[model samples]
Target: MSRKTFIKGTLILTLAGVLTKIFGFGCRIFLSRSIGAAGMGLYQLIMPVTAVCYAIGIAGPEVCVSRFCAAYAASRDHLRARHTAVFCFGMSMILCIICTVLSYMGADIIAGYIFHNPHVAPLIRISVFSVPFACIHCLVCAYYISKERTVIPAVSQIFEQAVRLGAIYIIVHIAHNKGEEITAAVGVAGLVCGEIAAALLCAAIVLTGRRKNIRTTRHPGIEVKQIIKTSIPVSLNRLALHGMQSLEAALIPLMLTVYGYSAQHSVAIFGILTGMAMPVILFPSTLTGSVAQMLLPSVAKEQSSSDKLIKSSRMALVFSLAFGFICIIGYTTAGAVIMAYVFDEPKLSGYIRIMAWLCPFIFINTTYKSMLHALGQAGRVLLNSMLSELITIICIVFLIPRMGIYAYLLGLLASQAANSALSICAFTRTVSRITTHKPLRS
Candidate 1:
């Protein structure tokens, strides 16, 4: 693609992502008001399981499809690109079904035993239905992304958020009027509905577009084995990363309880930090995240070209750092005021400040991880992720017990920093190796 087209695509996607995140954050604000801290806590506790399921079932395969499709298209192998998409979609469907079953069956154990909140089980089950929807939505979005078509996915995201927020308002209102306090569960149900709607919308868009570009070939070969080979390492990396994150979520309450806080307090604290503070602090990074998603295909297409790869990587890094810095400054200056006024929780300002410190690292890590996926260095990514998680677990195990909730946050910040460093190092080495063999001539 030309530079102009790429810039235009990036801008469109970035704007869409920013708008979607804004809506999502606004939804959270309304949810917090409707459900209160304790209810939000229940909502947050059930999320780690859902997040892990999503990571394992959808995220990895989606990226693999995006990367392979982009590379195949660049090589003028349209049939291969379509075949890869079909294979990835199939694998993602199988994974999603398995994960959904496990999620439904394990909801009670996760709620009662892990989080010590049995009331969250129903909410967990409701969220399970979203897995298949999310898997399909992500794969379709990846196909669009690989085709250098950003508008469809961007529009789909906006539509999805509209459905989600609208459903949440209606469901929560109905529940409130009934004199029942199930706002959190209602919120999750809205999420499931929205994801299913989005999946259907995107599927229609993709199928319609595919029909217009149909090639009457004797055989559009499906390379199922190659797709799985590329997907497995990426899948395992996502699994480990999400597994560690989930472990942190499940352990926080237990860790706090061991350090002399009640289950309610632990849940409330965890909810505010994860659902509220982290989202608020990282809101500004949505642009970078969106850009990184677009950048992956561009990078993969230009992987053998050192100058182009370096230029794209450096541009993405610069953008991520600049955005992260702005967020840090804004959040650091206005965090307390926003927390107090918006959330009505002045005490959460401290956690907000701590989490804000992690903004740059998180943003950088996200961009680098995307670039690595584009480079097909999934094994390296997995190793880096595992090492970072090990460091986090050790810190959490030792520090949370002795120093308390603050220690857990500190561990999180440290882990992100470590992961960012590792990603940067690996990315640098990969770029260097490519440049050395195939130098870009002036």
Candidate 2:
């Protein structure tokens, strides 16, 4: 968790993220061509549900594991760090298993009622199986991240994306050869395959690595009470945020319909925005995302040192904003060409360019929230995030019907701007308190 180590971890994860994005773009291209925009839209509808499930099962536990593991490892308490990983892994696995069962059983209900589209039920059923594997992958990655050992996590990330695109290509080819229609369900199947592959790889590494390291005697241990106390609030905050996000996502196409587009056209437009344009705009965030992720463990480790924490936070914020502005310039100039040529969706160029304005806010928010979480400000993160989502929802409900998709874009930009401002204010206030008083303990 030294500054050098933090930079090294960020570089490793950034490289991995870039490779993953490459493979992911390939997968997306194939899916968009094979199943079309409406199909991608149908597939995107289920993503929020999976995200909610991830929040419920893994998000809180991952944060807790990273924070606690970093603290324990810094104290040279390897035994406790190992135990924390195991405990969180077990807890997350059970929760994910329950989510899998419920999602599978209730896929029809969710698609028909929540999404108001029965066609996505099959995708839902297929996609839910990825949750347990994803939980496993993330928890293992969290542990390694805490140890500042990015090699395993980085490798697993690339391996997963490679396997996913490969699986999708093969499955879609087989289906085409068999004279069967290709659909978004194939895309969901590929996702599950990728997760399974990544989880197995991580599990293998952890098992082999632990053989010589685990000790027989117990030392001062991390208690279940401590884990719950840290994880539950974080979990609830994430659950609420993700729940609101899910609602926002679901309401988009529905609101678009109210804007005068036919059902099919509305869904297709939704697909283009979420699946195509959004990805292109967010492509540069891999660097910021990597920095933010590495910052979490480092920040957690340095939480007792006000000077170091403040310095790191300031550096992250500045880097993210500077990089984001550069992205805005690149996207404003070349984004249209990328979208038009890459996806063969010339219509997406406008969306991409328009959404380019979100880069600074999005990038800054990424780093700020990570540092906030590291500082045990999950409640602030939750509140700021909720306010953003609420703004988007309000716009979707009232404005989309009048101004069309442009209104939604405006809402997104405004919301991210608002969230970024709020996050900065919170960080400033918290760190000012630290500077004036004492460093806060996570």
Candidate 3:
């Protein structure tokens, strides 16, 4: 691959990132308005459960597919790369099916006990349909990303968002027209619709695209060892991390009630912070996230070239940190106006103001985590992420009642900052070993 390929890949992903975020932002605004903050709260509660299912279903293969395929592709082994994609798709499908079944069956327990809201069982069950389809989408996107063929994933992202928005609008309208309330359950249905549409399109692309693109090469590929080596560590890491995050998501609302707030009030507060303020806080990451994601394959491909690795690392860090600081400034300066204008939830402005400072930490940690995965140190990446998430959970567990949701915000920044520090240190050590111990070679 050439520099132009890398640049083109980054541009395609970045453009897609920007467009997706914009469309997603619009969706959040519309959803928040249609369902109200309390409904958003219920909706937010369901997402962590969905994420947990997704982590079980597809998270391992998603990263493994990208890293291993990139390595194989860089070696000019298209057959191994394609086989890896196929294998990952299979693994993801099986896991997602298992997760869907489990989630659907356990929806009552998850809603009543885990989420602390028995009323949320319907939404949880409804959200289960998204799991398998979402898993398929994840595997498909990772394959295209590894091959530097971003156009497929980019277009599919647009398709997903469009379908999601249209479905949501229609669902909300029909419910209102029928003189029924726009419950959060209806919101979950829209989520399922979008996932189904995206998955169908992605499977079509992956199948048809492969027939046109694949050519039998000498390399038959390792059936599953390499993928398993990477996936087990990554899977465990993500499962633990996201599982904790789900706890945090659920705990925050539950703890709010302990802080003397009503359950509805607490859920609304959680919804505002997550659904409204967070979208704005993370908007600028569209650029950095694309760069970080593309960096995985690029960095993996150039592992022996210290100069290239160092240069890529520096540029990603500098750009992400600078842009992240800009996000901080933007959110601090105009967060209130933006929230009021866009979401009409000016209450979220304070949360945004508090959380905006997390941008640099979040951005830098994201970039470095990708670097770790590219360096084949996914275990280290997972360790740091789990630590970060654990700290947030600690805060949510012990402090939310005393300090309110601000504690979670503080925990978010603190955890990200710590993760960034630790990951960068690990990355620095890895690069130093690669550069000093051996001569540069392709």
Q: Candidate 3 residues 387-432, lDDT tens each?
A: 8898998989899899888888888888988998998888887888
Q: In model 1, where is the ten-residue run with the lowest total lDDT?
A: 433-442
**Candidate number with greatest TM-score:** 2
TM-score of each: 0.94, 0.97, 0.95
lDDT of 2 by residue, 74-127 (tens): 989888888888999999999999999999999999888888898988989999
Give one digit per residue, the lDDT tens place, for model 1 in 313-427.
7887787778788777877788656875787776678787777888888889888888888887787889888988887777777888789888877777788888888898888
Candidate 2 at residue 20, lDDT?
A: 94
The lDDT leader among the candidates is: 2
lDDT value, candidate 2, whole model: 0.88
Question: For model 1, what is the error of residue 192's alpha carbon versus the real structure, in angstroms, after optimal superposition?
Answer: 0.3
Which 10 consecutive residues of model 2 have the lowest summed lDDT?
433-442
Candidate 1 Cα RMSD (Å)? 2.8
Evaluation by lDDT, superior candidate among 1 and 2: 2
Q: At residue 108, what lDDT does model 3 achieve?
A: 91
Compared with the true structure, model 2 gives a TM-score of: 0.97
Clashes of each: 0, 0, 0
Instruction: State candidate 1's TM-score.
Output: 0.94
Per-model C-alpha lDDT, please?
0.82, 0.88, 0.84
